[model samples]
Target: MLYQDHTSVVCKKQIFHTEFILRCHYYITTFDLYYTDQIQQTT
Candidate 1:
């Protein structure tokens, strides 16, 4: 029973880590696009 609980905790951690990475990637991509648009407008 303890082992099963540990496995479940690990799985949850993995899911959370994956979600965090994806969110960071989305934010970075959005920022990059916005930055490019701003630069283009200035020139």
Candidate 2:
């Protein structure tokens, strides 16, 4: 039972980390798009 609980905790941690990474990637992409648009408008 203890082992199962530990496994579950590890799984949850991994999921959280994955989600955080994805969010960061999305924000970075969004920022890049915004910058590109700005440059295009200026040009």
Pairs clashing within candidate 1: none
lDDT by residue (tens digit), candidate 2, 1-43: 9999999999999999999999999999999999999999999
Q: What is the C-alpha lDDT profile of model 1 across 1-43, one tens digit per residue?
A: 9999999999999999999999999999999999999999999
Tally clashes: model 2: 0
Off by over 4 Å in 2: none
Candidate of highest TM-score: 1
Give every collision pair in model 2.
none
Error of 1 at 6 (Å): 0.4
